[model samples]
Target: MVQTYTSPIRVYKTPFEFVMAAYEKRFPTCKMIPIFVGSEITSEITSEDKAVTVIERRCKLNVDAPYLLRKIAGVEFVYFIQKNTLDRRRRTLVIEAWNESFASRLVIRETCKYSVHPDNDDWTCFEQDAHLEIKSFFGFENAVEKLAIKQYMANIVKGKEVIDYYIQELIDEGVTHIPRFVPTGITEDSALDQSGIEDEITLSSLNHMALGATASSMTMDKRIHRDSLYKLDADYIHRCLGDLDPVEESRIVELKQWLQEHHKEKIPSDAHLLRFLRARGFNVEKGREMLCRSLIWRKQHQIDRLLKSWHPPDVLKTFFPGGWMDGYDDGGRPVFVLRLGNLDVKGVLRSIGVDGMLKLAITICEEGLVKCEEATRVQQRPVSYWACIFDLEGLSMRHLWRPGLKVLYRIIEVFEANYPETMGRVFLVRCPRVFPILWTLVSPFIDENTRKKFIIYGGEDHQQPEGGLTEYLDGKSIPKFLGGDAECGFPEGGIIPRSHYLPDDLAEMESGIDSISINSESLYQSVSLVKDSYHEVPVIVHDAGTVITYDFDVCKGDCIFTVLFTTSAVKIPSSTPPASPALQTSISVIHPDLKLKEVIRPIPCSDGSSEQGTHVADKAGTYILQWKGVDPTASTAVHSQFSFDFGLTSPPKCKVMYHYDILTQDEFRGSLSSVQSFSSLSMA
Candidate 1:
């Protein structure tokens, strides 16, 4: 198979003649590039006027192949045939070179061209294109392919420097410029009259001398110390985007210095720091503040551990659609494609609840970061972010449900705050009319910097003839659903059936508010209480012998907890709302003429921290777990303005921090067995 690479056009602000002089210095030997062993001019042809020179040469390269391959091939040096065509009249030089030593089993061909810049007479334009084919290489195709690409990429940087080095050499030697070739003699056949190098000559050179100076000859010496000559430090560039330029060197130094002085543990690498700087338009102070805050947030959230530890609940993983794509975008950023229109928004919320969905979102963002790190390793570049492509193919007004939108916006807000600059790009495709309405509602919440990265297309705008996704994505990586060649098998999107739901009790608990369960983040809830009123949560048990066990951590305030169970003879209040788990009025009002019992008193606390208890309901009834708060004046820690309560109108209030759970019947068998074991041990 053949591997080809075509570089983006590189501009050098130097004249063609000056660039040529530097190019010529790369032959035989150059310290900037030690791989080029030497070159021999096998043939040379010159025009009569010395205006053109065409040379054919055999260039030797010190191949950096594996030792085993070197031994197998039995060679230390590789040779290539280089053909050079220097057309002085046109101020252009084209070099074509092909490997000769490995022509049978492998082939390496490269073409390089240098011409006067179209818009600037004093500048030159250079481009390098290379192709490598390993027809059959002793089952070392992959290794050979990597070696070829590695060598080629290394030479690309070095080649530019070669010109720079020679330009500096000429500058230091006081040979500032080489005037364009011009014929002088009147006779066409005279050495001073004939046109040069238009017809033939093989130009062969393995590696260009120096990147910092190559082809950019005229400015070589000046660029040597200029901060913006290339990208961030070469090492940083090698680590993702070899082309990202942070604001300036001084700003980088300032930020790094600040981080070192003020925040040592959170100091970011130059490459990682660049993203934050870019997000804030390179304002060192603003970038530093954002970075510091992000570091704190990560530490507090334990985000480093989240990626490996946070897994979405099974119901959500299966029912809530949209997943990471198996492919990546053109720039090596992971591409996550989701068709929002096709997802069952209501169903998802009903299944996972707002908190579950939030967890899923956090997990997704965490996964993206993980993928970005992996890509950076694979591409040997800094790719700290991922690209997301949202396909609004089926988006409509139904998706704008008020509650779900609130959840989504809250999610967006969380992501915007916590994962700044995590989105490399967002491609909005097949947007429906409703999209704008939704966008208007949420766009204001999106970060301004993030808004700039959104690329939107209406209807089939992305598939139009104009520069579309194809401009940024490779053909094979494009999703076939988007009219590209690549096949995308993710999402498997559709409406999740109502039958997909778990039991109503389970669903209610998962959805929150309607059930006793609360998000782990809000495990300990606070209740404000008055001296006479009680905060009660009723547990309705249908069968006898049901077990109700609960646990709660007290974060603040104090209260006495007791179990209130109803008698079977008492009729449930007809006026009471069916979903009301508690009667705001005193329990006596509901069980007026019957038994209302307190099965357990205020439990003694082993430590003044939390409370746990278990109860067995031998008869069907309504069980109320109540927190009866007392006046703060009774507490040991005391400091207050009012020495006494005025009246019922301005009575002092109490508060409690608590959480509870129930395990019924068979579910508590393990608990019963453990209790039995403890009882037997105590007796022993």
Candidate 2:
């Protein structure tokens, strides 16, 4: 007969423990059934429903049980039940049984495994001893611990590289820090212990390691150090205080004592203190309080030295003499004379104790002087001497004094009043130093004639006359004239005056008379008439005759004539005898190409008929006879030939006259005259 029975079960909290406990609880018992059932277990169990006989029990099993059983081995029975079973009681039973069986199996397994491998236990003991030996030799638990030491060393080297980079960066950025010595290796083992580290050692070691790590990583050296730490000393603190100025030092000393009492870590350096003071504009070089003390000391020393060496009477005498003006002129009326020097008279006056010296100096400078002796000597000689005096006075006074337009008229008035005789003379004044001032001062005031005179006198490279103002002022005499020779005879009989003898004897003439005489024919020889004129109006002829009675009563119009003579003679005779009246008919006979016409009275326009305009004539053709003649037969005719051929009868007749004046006329005549005369006979 066969007995059918289910397998014992277990329950567990975790799947793995439940599976493991369940297997331990049932595997040994299940293995015993296979031995017990053997051939009968196969006979009782069919493929779908079978019973396996085990120690005093029959177990039902599935055909898949063998596969499931194989997986359940070594798994905790409770873990197995939890993982696979849904039945509560089965899970519970499995868990309880797993707990019980696991303890028994473990003890049994250890007993069996130990019995089988007594030499393996010895090898385990040997391994523990080997680990202890390693710990003893290297002072570390394992290879990891030794490797940690090497890692720490590597970290320190890496930290140094970081510190180098950081420090270089700090320097590049211009930050200052204290220098520190880099540690070569861990010097003492106080930082580490066998287990790990003592608390204080851990903290200190950590701090140092952190500091080194941080500093190395940042490439910075430690700022604070044991060597740099100084003890607070009263004497050293007092010395530091003394280095500062008195005011600042007192404050600093107070702060120092407070810091010392409180045991504060930070204290400013003297350099930093100076920078603060400098930023505040205090005198840091010789500190503010020190400078004041030095100044006071110097002042006191100066007072003492002065008290030792001072003499009141000598000092008073040096500044204030009893009489400054011991030997200067006084009591007489002040006559300020301008000295020939460029002295600052106003500055000199301010220096002296003169009551009115400044005013007097300015007056004298403005109103220049004339030496009375010089003026008197010049006045004594009446021939051109007066002219020299006038020129000299003008140079010194008029030219030197009149500085501007506002004062010019006043200065001129003063000059005219002082030197009334200057008008009659050709004044010329020249002085090297004052002349420039005179030129600048009076140039704007004077007439063009006076300016010309100045230019002739003082202009660059001027050839001064023999007896000018310069010669007179220098005490030189005028040159005396010598007598003429017997060969200096006047010329005879010519059409115009041959006054050549006058020039020949001019230098030899003792008398100052610049004159010469000419024969009547010579005076009248070149005189000729324009044709077509009156009988009563006469023309002077070249043949020592005049046309006083013209045949204009029987003939046509008025005539014109040119009188010519050379001015080479020094003196011109005032009067000459009248020429014969036959010169008029002789002129008509000589110029037969000219038509004769009768003269008539010119009709005068009413008082306001003629008006001035740019245009003079309207008609292009020749105009009839018109003249302001004394005789009825004196008519003047205009020819178109005269207008177009000669270009003489133009609107600008005055311009022609002025143009001829500079080129051909005598200087005085050119300066004075309005009328111009053209002479054909003079051209010959």
Candidate 3:
């Protein structure tokens, strides 16, 4: 009967991801489980039997129990269960299985495959073996039909002989290509003690294998040796690969041929070699051509001599003079130095043969020649000269040394002090210091103070003013000085006039004064003169012709001065006349100070029967008028007096006219006229 088994499976896209996932799934749950994983095929019944045992022990399932099984090709599974017995023990289980025919067929259809061939093949035997391992591990049912696997297998068969030869060569070179399970003798001491040639040969062989050379011909023992060698000196092997001489014409040609032969194969292309050369700082194009030519003449006389006699010490000493081996000679063992000139150029040259040495020498010689030329040119050029003068008053002295005036001065001073007569003949003074000194002395001065003032003219000055000039210069008090009107004149008795007076005729004075004459009779009409008691003294009147002088004392004391004219019943005209009897009694007096005042007084008027001339007196002087009238009670009374200090002219006729015809003769006449009766007074 066909046996069936079930196991818990976890699937992932990559082997590494699968392993990690399986570990996480199995840890901490079941500890006692048998796990087996390898890339090999066995009978189906045997695989089923093993799966049943693992499930019964780890999943605690009966041997005969029915279960479902799921598997994905190229994937493995892990499971956990309990073991039988009174005290059941937990354990883990793992299994491998293949996918169904449909999925396997699909995988085979989608992949790429190739047929085996003897030449013009692709892929490596080692990669083919890895592919087989992956197929087995994943239980790939149709793995043989999968294109990737088929192509890999075909390349393995086709390149079988070439791969075998390569592996045998590596073994002869002391490199084991396939390792077995054994302790490798790769101690640090063994690697450190390796001879230079042995180290280089081992490194080169290992690099070839690491770069995907087939190792099918390597025996298990040889494989172990290869692995041991790498473990001992992996870094050295890596360094050798990087230092591969792109300009070693023979090696480059061989590599190129190999690449061309397997162009269709997945071997590294020419671009890869170019990248390798570039990483080593080799000029790829030049190195490639050089390497090809060198390879074609591999056995030439000069190359043979170079390989036999050339040593790293000789190269180092020639390229780098004194310091070549400074820090590199450790205990006389010549510890490898990876300095720029040593490891980079020298190492590449050693790998490439005699031509590389010649190229390196040429480069070093050219660089040295350039440096020597630069040094010689620098020595030949003239040195620059500079001098300075300090503590000088004028800017010329300070700037003189800047324009070579100092050197010129030195020449002149030396000539003058040593050979004055020779200096005149040589004209050295004119040629040197004398002309320069004259130029400096005569150059127009640029006052720094003026320049700075012009620059900041609008800026405020914060410095305090000195001396008594402070008050005059202070901007805040300038207005006070400008607006003052102080009396200013020359000193007394000084030669200069105390005051400069212009001649009166040349003064062109304003016409503001006049003179006039009047008779005493006409003076009565002149109120100004009448009010002044006909004073004949020359009195000045303002332009208004009003007698500005009057005697208030006489008017108030009731002094009567005469008028030469006869009294008329006709009224004297004036701008304003009395409007009431009380007002008629009112009198105005001009005080000595030119201020006017009203006085009250009693004056007698003529009786109507009395002739108008009855009141006239023999007094011929101008008289001042005084009047008195009763108060509102008709019992109490008040008096008014008026006096004008008039000129000897008839009082300028009163401009106003008053009418006396409207009153009856009895009413119009009274001892004391009513102030209202003057309302009709006329003015001439």
Residue lDDT tens for model 2, 6-112: 11111112232122233333432343223212111112112221111112212222121234333543331211111112121111111111112223222110000
> Where is model 1 more than 4 Å wrong at Cα?
1-247, 264-269, 380-385, 497-684
Which scores higher on TM-score, 1 or 3? 1
Candidate 1 TM-score to native: 0.42
Candidate that scores best on TM-score: 1
Predicted structure with the largest lDDT when compared to the true one: 1
Q: Where does the lowest 10-residue lDDT sum fall in candidate 1?
A: 199-208
Ranking by TM-score: 1, 3, 2
TM-score pick, better of 2 and 3: 3
Q: Estimate each model's TM-score.
A: 0.42, 0.14, 0.16
- Superposed by TM-score, candidate 3 places the C-alpha of residue 315 at a distance from the truth, in angstroms, of 18
Q: Encode model 3's per-residue lDDT on 1-684: one tens digit a residue.
A: 111111111111222212222333342332322322211222222232121232222222111111321234222442222221110010112332222333323322111111111221221111111212222323433443343334433333333333344444544777543221121354434533443355456656775666533353244336555433212111221222222221222233334444444343233323234333332344444545443443333234243345336444433443422111111111111111111111222122223322333433333322322332333244442111101101111222223221122223332332222111110000011011122333333222322221121110000121124312122222321112122122212111111121232222321121111111111111111122122132211122122212221211111112222211212121223454344222333222222232221221322322111001113222222223332211221223432333343445433211111111122223223212322332222111
CA shift of 205, model 3, Å = 31
lDDT of 1 at 4: 59
